[model samples]
Target chain A: MELPQKYSEQELVWLLKQRNEQAYSYLYDHYSGALFSIILSIVKEEELATDVLQEVFIKIWRQISLYDTTKGRLYTWMLNVARNTSIDAIRSKGVKNSRQNQELTENVYEQAGSAEMKTDAIGLRKLVHTLKDEWKILIELSYFEGYTQDEMAKMLNIPLGTVKTRLRSGLAALSKIIKP
Target chain B: MNTQEYIESGIIETYVLGMTDAIESAELEQYCREYPDIKLAVTAFEATLEQHALLNPINPPSTIKVQLFESLKDEFVHPVFMSAPTKQSAKVFDIKPFLKYIAAASIILLVISGAMNLYLYTKLSNSSAQYQAILVEKTSLQANNQLIQAKALDLFNSMQMMTDPNMLKVSMPGMPGKEKNYATIFWDTKSKDVYILPNKLPQPTLGKQYQLWAMVDGKAVDAGMIGDCAGLCKMKNIPSATMFAVTLEKKGGSSIPTITEMYLAGKVS
Candidate 1:
């Protein structure tokens, strides 16, 4: 069953404090698949991805008591958990280096947004596909690859200022395309 | 700033793209917190980014989700794990096993328990068999003892025929030189029978019976003969005896006792 709408994020946190199994299961249903997909994308190995997913949940459970509503929303906190956990998986194993991962991200640049995915994600991928090439590359570097502007500048052999401007310019163009 | 004024700066979009620095994010967060429109703008932008990832989402194999869920469910207490806030939280949880591990452990426990049960059953049977063997041997020994008891009872009944109702017991005391040596004879004058018990007498010198005589007024009359009853030292009923004596003599009975050979004598009193 779906989470009841009257239960605000505050009420949900209260329910979680009670250590309600229903709340935990409800939370997982909404986020586990998505978080697992993100982790598997970064970790690649199914076994390690599974491990990281469990670690993320354990962390959430242990630190839920510390969650402050004033800091930001629950979604932002959860995304941080997911991103940090995936990165931690690589570091803890000491096997996967980001430099190595960058080399293997696949020539996905050309066909990245063109996959005929069967999920509801296909529509969103189509929106990203609708963007122009020059803009899409910078977006991918900043978002998917999690590169800093200075790193992007270094990789492309451009001035840091130029990388920042193009990235800002490109995102502006893409936001327009997304809206109307 | 108007939409174009804000859009023209390209900073809001950068803030939206999350490529902004700490100062920039703080500035944006402040502006978003102050202005409802700016917060909406940020939410909309972040939502769009999330959507893009969703659109191109790499749907991992269905098996991967199942694997991830199951693995998390089963937690072995490896040192790598951090405990929950309480010890009680660490327990009271089910250990859902990985599929590969579940298969292996099931096979192992089945084999071990099966072998143990079989060994126990065999031991029980062997112990029962040994107990039954001992019981059979006990039954046979009891039967043999019963047979021996029946034979002893038969012998006792046959000896009843030798009893004399009117018999008188005569004690024969040893002579002066041989005290502690003695014999007894029972005389049934009505039946003219006598019974001798020469158990207290020492071994005779030759193959001889201790002769008995009836002496009336110092006159000797032949009564009967006595012979050793081997080591059993027992004798049965005979004809008669007025007085009895044991003496060393020849193999057969004599009508009178040799005075030098008389070992014991007694009067009918």
Candidate 2:
């Protein structure tokens, strides 16, 4: 049977688990650049970063079955793989020259699962740009931090209901902007 | 309480964001099982969030995609190895590392190499040293043989001279401590050449060697020292003499033989 053209994140994951090359190709062509930037930023060595990038995809290929869409997006899962791999590479290469500016350097991407997102992926920055600040923050925290709304609420000092309300509205608004 | 009201209230967003307290997520899960609409709203909220992240996903360079594609292709193609039909096919294939064999082989190789080198070095040195010693021995043996041949010819020629009219022949009697030793003397009086038969003696201790003295009226005159030749025995020269005596003495022989120490005597006629 021909693979479906319109695949949800879960649907594409299922196809990848079943060893679908078309789905893998689509994911790569669409998302590799954003992942590359994350990897490059974390691992300064270009060649080593490239190796880690290759490993990230290989792991994605072999371990796609482990991804649970109920827990997070495929991009979030993939980005975590890349980030962890790069950090591991940094340790393995014994990189001691990194600046000590830990907190100051944390952009949305510095969040473990944050850069794993596709905001700039497939040019989603344009769509995400149309979103208000609250949506961006919600997206940055939830998807990036791997935070539950409870965690987000605690972190932002907002009520749980407010965190929930903001996330739902932010997502719904994103749908209209991107899909519309 | 109404499921539709709950859906409209956007409780699904809290579920997707995991912002709701544990009891709330459990309640939503219960609702999802009870009504499909609640599940639909939940998936809808999750889908938009996922899609948004997907749109902004961190894509690595093209190489990652290529590597990913290869793995995907492997799953698609599932190529089999040539020799190994199944990795689990054989007992050999199933076997873990044979470190024992590797260790044994390496050890044996190292030992054999070490021993062989040691043996070769010893053998080479032994052969070279033996060859050098043999060369030295052969050279000395050749020189000794040549000296003996020349002495034999001299003894023969000197005997012929003794029969000549101008030469005198004398026999020396072994006397006193030299009772076992006797010698013949050929004195070429005209030429003042004296050849003694068997000019040989054993080694002496410190300050001692045999001295040959020419006797004139029983007083000794110096001839030369003797009995310490390191080379082979041969006939040797002496001066023409009225009489001959040998005595043991201090090294280089005293200016004259100490008469009390005379070991042998001969009268030349």
Candidate 3:
């Protein structure tokens, strides 16, 4: 039976390790929206994004034991997985041809709320909007596109040091607003 | 850079965002473990990223969740990779041949188990029968022992009676035709009790019994009948009897002595 109540992160992790079906349902119910948003931001299309999301969940199930609680929160680790899997899907040969015409930078600054998704992150959206386009693009490229510092530096025709600085300042500004 | 400068350098941010390469991520993790402030900053950025991700919610189509869960159900029985339907076709092999072998092995095991059960049941019944026979034999032996014990006690009492000074043993000789048959009478003078031992009496014909008679005063008094007695038979009490005799009569004794039928005669001293 699906639990009606919320589980603490530790409780959820314990249930997940035991491979509890209810925990899997709870996990899907609780985090799929956020994860789907991240996946869609990368893959851009709902059908391909849906496939990427499913692959992300299967990876999470198979690699749940590898989750190191000492490093980060469950959502943070899952965000990483979702971003990586979506990037892999688009990078694969099948997606590259169909998606060649669309520029990656176009969707980099695209607001999730502007799409069909509900605007629950209006507060965070305003805070992100206040950030300079240069700083915002760096965070989006690395966070959503799963680009490394070197890759972002080369793509933007900038030094690797500038890419690292912008990403740091962008996260610092967002962290202040979100936590404040 | 030092740990504080390192914390401020945005490396932890890249690490939390999954943008760091393997070398950069591993080095940052080592620093995070070594320094609590670096660790705290890492956790804070990770939390910030989580909150940001949660804020940007886009629900996937409802069908994917159902399909994902349905695919996961197969994982419990055998490990299944993601989207295996396409990959599995190349690896499909037939298992129909092994089914008959499995069925045959199962049937053989069933037969062996049934036969063992029947054999054990027969052995148990045989043991039970043997146990019952031993019990019956024990009871019969116990009954025979009790009978022998009673006989020994009787013989011991008879010995005591013969040795008693107040007892007078009277010898009875068989009549003219039955000269070989003889008997004895043990008469206790003090108790006035009469007992007879038909020591060598022949088995009488059907419907006839050998009986004892005591002559008291001038009249013959009827003692008691002796019927197939192997030991001392207590006859009727006689007071000052001068003679004792036995004769074959009917199954029960006759009221008067049949002189022609007399088999033994004795004079008491």
Candidate 4:
């Protein structure tokens, strides 16, 4: 059967629940790039992020039935799936290494090359770069790195309330900075 | 509750970021549905995050999509078999063994009557047949009672949803050419659940089904397909809408609504 090119969020959710193959392809084609970038930010390797993207899609396909629209938008839900899956991959990689290697794994970003990476949206990258260091760190750690608020507070040597406040303002600022 | 303070407190941002724990998330979502300001704040953050992702999309190798679809091919093989059974049928005790016992008893009676007399044998067999018929009737009545109970429970739930103060009832009258068709949507404001009751709407022709649309900000959002639901067919949950409509589409529904085939339309007040 011929499939429509674009689907509204609700229709996409419905068809995905039905396990429609066309819808699945539509979902991948439409959202994979965005999802890949999120995974790349967390995992920081195109090859690894590609693998994680596959896992994310598989998880989404298997668990589409459990998705509750009331919880959030479909992309938000999928983003969580992608983020969590990417985070899990990182944590497991750390666990697999020796204590020294684990520390090295954490610092891998400093040594990793950015030449091969292609984050096509130069404006978005520029906007994020323009944010204050603290705000950028807060967004990256929480959003990309999937760190919890309490963990961030301890790590940042700030009170839990401070972390909440900073995160709020940071996100609000980020939202405004990137607004088209 | 001061919605402005709550919004400014940053919980909505955290909630949109998927950082809020279950309880906090649930509370924020409740507030979102109840307070327009909170909802708008949540929506704004969600939109911002979506835009953020869209702006920084990194195309994965094209082969990944091909591999992904290949991995998912098994799911396509038996979608129907793997689907969860929708109807929970009431289990009735099997009556076949009872019929066998009755048949055996009649044969025994026949053997005994042949030795005693034929007249007594006919009377015994006739009474056994009557008893068997009564047994069948009783079981059928029990099954009918269970079915009625199930139906009653469904009616009760439908009524509760319909009578809920948070539920908005939108009566969609037929469009110009199909004026006789009508459907009512019972939408729960808090839960965002949508149920469409096709009252006078005609049955869709083969290979076609009626699809529900929630018009939000002048765009048609797919609510769900109206399949062969009897009393109150539950559609997808609609977060927000200004109007609702129904259009005939190919079976399984279309991604974009076929506006020309719209049969019913109604504004939400």
Best prediction by TM-score: 4
**TM-scores for all predictions:** 0.41, 0.36, 0.49, 0.55
Q: Which has the higher DockQ value, candidate number 2 or candidate number 3?
A: 3
> After superposing candidate 2, which stretches have Cα over 4 Å from the reference?
A1-56, A67-99, A102-136, A145-155, B13-26, B44-60, B69-269
The sequence of per-residue lDDT tens digits that candidate 4 reaches over residues B1-269 is: 88888877767767776777788888887887889898888877777778778767889999998898888888964422223324335344433435878979877876785676567567777877787788677777877875885676466457656767777899999999898889999988888999998899887799999999999998999999887654789999899999999999999998899889999999998
lDDT of 1 by residue, A1-180 (tens): 123423457766766664554566566665666666667655557788777777887777668888776655565566567666776675556444435666665643333323322223222233544567666566655654456777777666779888777777777776766662
- Candidate 2 lDDT, B148-190, residue by residue in tens: 8556545544544655676676776667776776656666666
iRMSD (Å), candidate 3:
14.8
Write one digit per residue (lDDT tens) for candidate 4, span A1-180: 124567788878876876778888888888898888878777776788889999999999999999998767888889889889988987777566546566445544432223212344233344655778777666666766567878778676789877778877776776676666
Q: Candidate 1, residues B1-269: lDDT per residue as tens digits?
A: 56445545567767644468798778877877777776766666666655544444444455644554465453322222322323222124344556988868977876896798689769967876786777677767767765665454344322332343455777888899889888776665565555666758776655765665566556656555666442212333444335666666677766667878787788887
Q: Indicate whether candidate 1 or candidate 4 has the larger TM-score.
A: 4
Error of 2 at B188 (Å): 99
Q: In model 3, which runs have C-alpha deviations exceeding 4 angstroms?
A: A1-4, A93-95, A98-130, B1-4, B76-269
- TM-score sort, best first: 4, 3, 1, 2
**Candidate 3 CA-lDDT value:** 0.76
Best by lDDT: 4
The global Cα lDDT (0 to 1) of model 1 is: 0.61
Q: Which of the predicted structures, 1 or 3, would earn the higher TM-score when compared with the native? A: 3
Best by DockQ: 4
Instruction: Please give the range of 10 consecutive residues that has the lowest summed lDDT in model 3 chain A.
Output: A112-121
